[model samples]
Target: MPQANVDFSLKETAPNIGGGRVSGSEKLTSSFDLVEQMHFFYVRVVRVRDLPRTRNPFVEVNIGNYKGTTKYFKMDHDPEWNQVFAFAKERIQAVTVEVTVRSKETINDEVVGKLAFDIADVPTRVPPDSPLAPQWYSLEDESGRKGGRGELMLAMWMGTQADEVFPDAWHSDAATVSGESIANTRSKVYISPRLWYLRVNIIQAQDLVPISRNRNPQVYVQAMLGNMVLRSRFSPDKNINPTWNEDLMFLVAEPFDDPLILSVVDKLGNNKEHSLGMCTIHLSKVEKRLLPIPVCANWYNLEKVAQDNQNNMEVKFASRLHLRVCLDGGYHVLDESIYYSSDFRATSKLLWPPTIGVLELGILNATGLLPMKSKDGRGTTDAYCVAKYGPKWVRTRTIVDSFAPKWNEQYTWEVYDPYTVITIGVFDNCHLQEGSDAGGSKDPRIGKVRIRLSTLNADRIYTHSYPLIVLQPNGVKKMGEIQLAVRFTCSSTWNLFQSYTHPLFPQMHYLLPLSVYQVESLRHQATQTLSLRLSRAEPPLRREVVEYMLDVGSNIWSLRRGRANLERLLATCNLLVEAWKWFDHICKWKNPISTMVVHFVYMIFVLFPNLILPLVFLMCIVYGASQYRKRPRHPAHMDTKLSLIDSAHSDELDEEFDTFPTSKNGEVLKKRYDRLRSIAGRMMTIIGDLATQAERLNSMLSWRDPRATPMFLAFCILASIGFYFIPWRLFALGVGFFAMRHPKFRISIPSLPQNFFRRLPARTESMI
Candidate 1:
């Protein structure tokens, strides 16, 4: 095997190559430390020459990555080693070589280096042949029965030299040989129904020398598994192939994006089949197999075979065994054996006034062999026969093979109420009659209905079949619920939804009731309410029937359109859609021009009167201001202290001013009003900054509440009223203007009389 040739075993003791006295051990160790710190290292080989004359001569080199994997470099055993040395030097950097061989031991005058590769350097694609390569066989694939369409794949490595081919199974360290080898490399021919696939690894190299007595040179090669594979059917606990004595060895390849496909075909028809939703040809060894789908059965019929004697005697008899097998694969002359058994008897007036006839059958076996069941061999076989014989003795016969007379047996049977049987029929809903609307709208009930069964004799009891009644509202609807009534025969002990079918269902001697009842409603409301009722044959009123009436609740009924629980679901959906469309129209519509004009006129009428007076006064002032004469400027008082005292005692002072206490004898009160005004102005500036900072933070957390819009309008009205009271204060108006984009502070008197303070400046500076 190529794996053995490329021995991946780690060898740490490497010889130094310099053709001189070994020295500088400390320096070498220091260099290794530096390389380790760098987290990278490289190996350079000088050459490999002078090998035996084998089919392929290869030298294995090791540079650890995953554990220590070795790669083979093949070269010829040529005397002239110059070309080989050149090849090896080109591939590797000599300065940073981690492993080197300086001088070789002389064997009969031929100097072979400690490491075979360093003996000589050569550059060539084809390496010398090695003895191991010729003895190994290439794993290949061949087709079995079908037109030789087969493929084969093997995981191995690349070698430098020809004879350096990887080892075969015998030379491999991980070849398990207890089980049979795959017949062909192609999966189709190597079908192993008893085993499941593990993994497949395509590596660069695989080689191993026998290292222990217990471990063979060739060990088993099982597939590699990641987490997903380990969780599958072949877990470690059930890994049959990998025993403790065997270990799968390989050059574990790098993971790939795509998955591998394994296919196999079983030649022997001995495999058991299971119709678990599909006709699966079970294989224990192979993981999976894609089926070659055959043409489906279209025109088919149940057929009972009649046997003719090998001799000249003529006989007329129906075979005991009857099968409903499809003839899609074409008619087959079955040479295999057939098994069957039946019991027949007559009953008296036990079936009531009708005096019904009953024929019971006790089939022991119908197929050629026993049913392939579970590992424990529980009740895997189905009860294939039943009937109501009306309390009478019935004769029965058993047969191993219908074709062979020696395989027959006989037995006696009696009628019973609770027995089991298997029956099959094709479902045809087209011919069924619509059930009568017997159940009222409020009661949980089923309409009078009967399932039409064909080919069943009147005397035979139809037990297992269940009758189902379904009612759907008529026409296009958005919301509605469906009422279903499923009644089963009293003999049926369980419903079909459950896993186990009650054995008594098939033993009923007469027609049985339906097995299930259901009321399926939509979750959404309807878009339209239609009064047009369903036909008389249809059950429009049946809405309460359910599989289990007590289990359903009104909470599940929905107002949402198109929901399952909504009564008249389709209608409800349509109605909701209409409402949404009406709202959408209101949103998209533009008001008429006449209406808009009326609104505008009304608004002007309501507001124009209040605005007229202010507008008229403003206009008069603007017009009259051009004709007014300018007032003469007043001079400042130089003797302000004497002037103030005399002015304070002036007779112009009102008696109301006398009420204020004087600062001294008959003196005017010394008030700090001017200082207070100055301080108040400074405080206004600080307040403005604080307001600005608060406003900034408020803006940061500004969230609009739709419900607060009305309150905000009311606040604006209050602010407007407050501002109206301060006629001459512009700052007051600014404070009231809460919706202003940016605020500025200025003091101005809009209504102040000019003569009131003629000496004072008209507008004060801003506090900012």
Candidate 2:
């Protein structure tokens, strides 16, 4: 099979090409040190030359330890094998691209020749636009002897850092901003460094240097840490003692290399700004004090930018800024609350008392979704859900050709602050075809809901459907509703701490410490098992039972369980349940509106077939243009106060409809409880009836029944072929004509096959 090759080139000014070989002891020592500063090396194998003629020749190429083979070519001397491999910089330091030629034989493959080249000689860095071109290299034999008469064309280059490669829009603070420019971000390929949040409160400035003798200084503070910069609001008309009590936060990488620079600048009348004095706070000092908690607020004197001995004496006593700063060690850059400006700390203290708990969130399913119009005029949606809690984010699989998608996925996240909110967003997956206009492309957001952990009662399971609300340019719209089950299990503070600090536990302190590949692998395995267990069980497992199994199976209870425990967990799940759910969902009829709209379109097509295509094409063009014009040109950050107020309003609505009795009248409360119980019993009866019908249908369609299996297969084949050739309008018309009529007419029309084939001999009788 042909493999995709990534091309890279080496610079002429490569480093240390002729360095002496290190001893095994030295190599081992340096290897550990080099691991910390590891970078990605992309090695591309382009082609091979001067190979000996063979019946079927193929070349196996190895970079570092990973190996790949080329397609075997019949009687070919020179074979092309374009393949790329990525390795860590530490491993590539003494890496060799080893190529071995082999001939395919009837009994066993025979080795024709072998050669290797050291890739350590390649340069580390190059300009982004100008990459090194592919070049031919002489291959060497096993003993470092130059006897092989073969050459390999190879190219290699260093991969750029994520921050440098991704566009600014990706890192922007706006959620609604179009991510078309983020196409090449490749965030999955790189792991972000551990990050910390630095909160700075600009309390006030006491006695600052005046810009002029008569004019009052409009002083504002600017805090800088590397590339991140934040500015405080200006203190107008407060020259002598400016007071602007504003808070600002900066997301910084761990091992904090740079000092936080705070500069007081005066706004001039010409719209220009002039710096008065500046102070530097080394993050190293902050790190030392953040062991237990951040350091207390203190007044620090600011140093003069340009010292004049005579003027400095006059300003020395007054040049100081009263600031309160602290390092928030637990924050992850990606998990910084979208509504961080909101006062969550104050709200937490007001709403719920302090408690320690783990929040178990089950994203069960979503229903009543609004179908998006596809290119072919079919109402369809590819829906997926993204749930984020603190630093962790979990994305469920995309359910294609579905309106009511049942994910039945569960995730758990540690909750340090009960006040913090978890945001779950459902979106329509839009694939952009090649050569399409980027600005015109749109990925429709179905809806999003945020839930605060503090609002829920501890140890109580709350499973309910929350309406998926969306805000469009016109107004707020009800997209659908998502069914979620959330339970917070309270644990003692000491126990929680012990679990976190356990020696055998994998590092859960950092947000998602596992690599992307590892996380993906675990999720895939778990999903497969869960799906399997749901299917084969005689009685379907309860949602609570499934969740409990998942919690145990996922190794979230304790990381020390390792691989054996995970495999055991996987074995307990049934796959058939998942398959059945999907099949049933797809086969069911859509909503009333969807059915009406589809039939209406079909009627138009049947009446005027030629005009239907032209009308659809024109509508698409108009819609795309309108969407392009409506796209936000600038990023807009969430309004914290508005978000909080909206959440409070939602809470009020929930309380109004809550089933629990809030009144003291025993008779009234008893009546309410009786009514609710009756409704629940009726719902259970309906569900049981539906299940019975489903089982009857399943048995009739089962392949285990010899009489039914052949008939079902024959019907399926005939239906598939008929649907392929028939126009959708004609199908819709035929179905509508029969559906609108009485059952007496429908039953009399389908007895032809049974009557005509009654005399046919059975397969068993023919064998006899």
Candidate 3:
């Protein structure tokens, strides 16, 4: 599929989103974003003592125009807030950083004490060195003389980002956030829990006694893991003994606390069901198999529940269920789209791959944005950005009440494969207010962009403003635009290139590939497991968000998707048609002089065939160079094509949104069936044509058609004998001359080879 790409680029240098503006003369086009280098100045406020007896004593940190306040300590003389405040050196325009201890008890909010550090006096402490120790600073009054109000313990040092505290420290870049919620804004790393594929194979059941003989029972087996459920087809024979060779798979993590529940279900009249017998299998007791080896099935005695007058249930003997269950740890569970999977590691920890490179993302800002919803009788948007690459996901602080928000934040991930994608999404922060949190409403999305690493040139910064497009029930909508600067730095070029020669997945995938049904089922299980795990993290990812990101429902048939794919196929096929038209025009001598030039060149190449390879390669080079002028700057995602849409039937749209087993009535189902048959009829013709072409080629050698085989053999024998006697160049030259003969002498009919090949016998006659 072709994307709509644009070259909306940055102004050479990194944007100064803090206190100052960058001049055009200072802009850099080098590999490095010069303005991104930072001297991270940190001020760690360990504790405070000898404070005035007042309620709510807090410390305020101010650097340049950025201000951050510590938590209030009510009625406490001494407050300890082991909090750190950091600032970007280049963005700090002030000569000194001021830390003030203020009392919130007074009506005027009186300042208790204040201290300042000159920018030149700060010590430069490199990483791997011992951290700078805190020193007691004497409280000063308005006159700059020492006072007895309070003494604050502070550690001030300028260090590079490699410092251990760089990740956890609060920076001025996100100074607009409240002090209480600052922790939620900073970058943090999260590793996904080790997940394994749990397989449950139910073979057969024996000696099942029916509770009521008068009622005919339709029996089937059902398996449940957590919330996901799977059912086997009902047995055709209504008997005590039944067999259902079926497999149900689930994604399970460590701890193994969840138990797999299996039950034999019986269907009764009036659309009712009864559990005849049930059994539980603890995951810890289930066998663990890394490979796809056959495991012996074991019988678990099922139990029947009976209730007494006291309501206590008693377990009674029932039939036995034969099952084979195992924890498969060999496969790399795919919770993401196959084309955009960030991780390629197997379930077992030992099978993890090595880190390949470093991926850095600079979230510049967003522009031309509209409020997601109305607020306070006016439209406003509190926008924040969330970027997820590999296992780590980072969320920036919400820039409240702004159409264009600038978050000069950068994040990095260890890239294991160049094929992985980084997804960045902008959303309206719904959880900021108390009411929304109580209701557990998720943030409304603004837009999302996915950048695949393979499309990027290594070691270069690509800055572009990508349009944020959202797909709605009505059609595709352009939400806004977001500017991002991305760079992918490879750790080892050899290792990165060597990965291309190796298998895309683990070797086991090629050796023993999973069935299409299993792949779909397991992918569903993987998404469920991932959503469950991510929802448990600090700032939870909602189920809808995860499903949207992973495209869980994309596999369900969509007429729009089918039409788009069909268009893509036809566009590819059009190239051949256009090429043949050009060839026909040339041979028809539409341009006599050009046709003579083509004939002259063709004669030279045919007579001296050794130059053919060179000419082909030279043309390839010329075509590549010509295309350089039309190269796309930024790799685009989410091409919005609203053609209203796809002019499909109402029933087709309903069927597209239907569940896996379908929830429609019989009438609607019949209409869908007729539509599907009509579509498949055209598809069957295409497939039959392709089959005929292949079968005709086989008939020449297989002797399936006696006349076709003899004709092909005679041509082959005559050509082979002539080639052995005459020079191949002379024969090709003679053929070229004949093809380029004057238009008056040329025959206005199809070639002999085309006529003969069209007459070749095919197997279409054997079709029903």
Candidate 4:
């Protein structure tokens, strides 16, 4: 036999940070620690074979405080996992990495075999170099002595981020997620199924047979598609042939297999209904409409119900119902609200538009955050951020026990439309158990921010600190502020503009539009699918985080939101009201010279009708030029009033945060119900007021008022005769000159038309 050759490598001495002298062993240990900090050490558990009669065999890796287990294989002598586990060298406290094979079929998870590799024995490999080839090692006992008749094949190496499996490898950073949630920490791809809009336009029904002719049978069409059922308003004719020009829509996905069922029912007293006829329409055979053109209505023969008894069988009459059904592909099926929706791709792949730009968001850090939960009587927070855009979502690593955490992570997405928005929400991570000081199970929201891509200028970066305000039951609380840097870079200006010219949704939508509720329901499905997919990624974002960030409960009943929306409407109306006031002031001739000048300008425009549009456009240009200095100097931020957080009632705020299905006691619910009725009363009054105004205009011809209808008809007939002979310019001149007449000539009382319309009878006075 050849003589055994022994080789030794030189050990370099690592100088102490204090420049003090150290022993040889100390120097060697310091050198290893220094090396560990700069590199990553990992093992690829590849395969195992030749097991000697073991049941439910599995492999578990042990490294210091960390333990990872592979999936178990039953009734098999050989198993392949091909999993990778990476350790941050600086965090590893052990000198050796152990790989143990066990039989889980036993209650104690019986140890079948084991292998140990000293940390120093692990080889160093970098990318550009071939992957470390795995070799078979004999199974041994804890004493390093061969005991089991099996072999394991795996590779051990040190590498950087450039490693082939680096992105997918299980890392120590995410080990705190717990072994049970391992699947949520891996990378995955989820594809959403293409969906379309199914529209069922219920037209008039012919040859209808009523159950009772004396009752003037009230008829309505009830359509059932899947679990959803919608009923059209009762027909007004109430005859054998009822006309109902109503349309019912639904959201349907591809591979259309469901059938649409239509039932013609007659409403009777005592909460009873009688079916006149029924028909079934197959979605696969429905027409496909892409454009806004009208769909051709076809009459389908409705089958009458046949009742069979033990003694006799009775056959009912047949009827025909006019209907128009089609699958609309022209519209984009919204699975989320447009305000913060990331995905805008058409329901059908064929109708998907082209990309326009790239959106990059940098999650820098947060500051001045209040502690979310208490630990050992002291408040603390573990904060993280989740950003979603289009089909891609990114979650930053949690910064534990921090008040001001810095993430500084950047993510990018391909933008298809500038009008789309990206949502970023900061949340407290209360689920982490390892080294967790703050104790809480629910991840409370810090705040959320939404930025529309269209608002961002191309190639310009917007960096701002957005305030996070959370509305609690007691009041609105200032959570903290997050700093973010966002940039939207357009690839080509031409392409961006081209996207605007294209249809907002696919052409199929216009041909067969879906109802608002259908779109909302489908949006929930899309979000569920997205949540399932995103949970599979490395360091998965929890479902609560996803729901909170996406604002799945935003539509929940909120008195605060109602107030905010009402304020918005008032603000919009205020502008027009203010404009009217200004006009009234001018007409009052408060400034005689200005009013006279207005009258002159108005007369000129009336006399020269061709110059009217030019003068109006010129005024607009002048107004825009004058307001240039008052333009916004900075980007808009969240407003307490706009969000309705400031001055919100405690009860309203409580209801906003109330759990779905209501977890409150009966007494609390009763109080809430009373408050809700009060608020609804105001809304009802406003609605009634608006309806009265609209009805007054209709009553001029409706003959609801004994005197108003005939007077209005006589006035219209005389006006028509005058308009037929008089030129349009003459009419304009007469109206303008008369309205702009001097204050001395004007009357202080209300106009005759206003008084006449207000006095007209309205349906409101008859209501109880």
Which candidate order results from sorting by lDDT in descending order?
3, 4, 2, 1
Q: Using TM-score as the measure, which candidate wins?
A: 3
Model 3 residue 433 lDDT? 50
Best of the two (3, 4) by lDDT: 3
Q: Which stretches of candidate 1 lie over 4 Å from their true place?
A: 1-61, 64-298, 301-768
Give per-model TM-scores.
0.12, 0.33, 0.72, 0.63
lDDT of 2 by residue, 202-314 (tens): 88888787778688888899998775577998886466788887777665554567799999999887889888888889876763222324356778788775558676644
Compared with the true structure, the alpha-carbon lDDT of candidate 1 equals 0.21
526-591, model 4: which lDDT tens digit per residue? 556456555554565656777776667655566666665555546535657888988898989898
* Worst 10-residue lDDT window, candidate 4: 1-10
lDDT of model 4 at position 354: 76
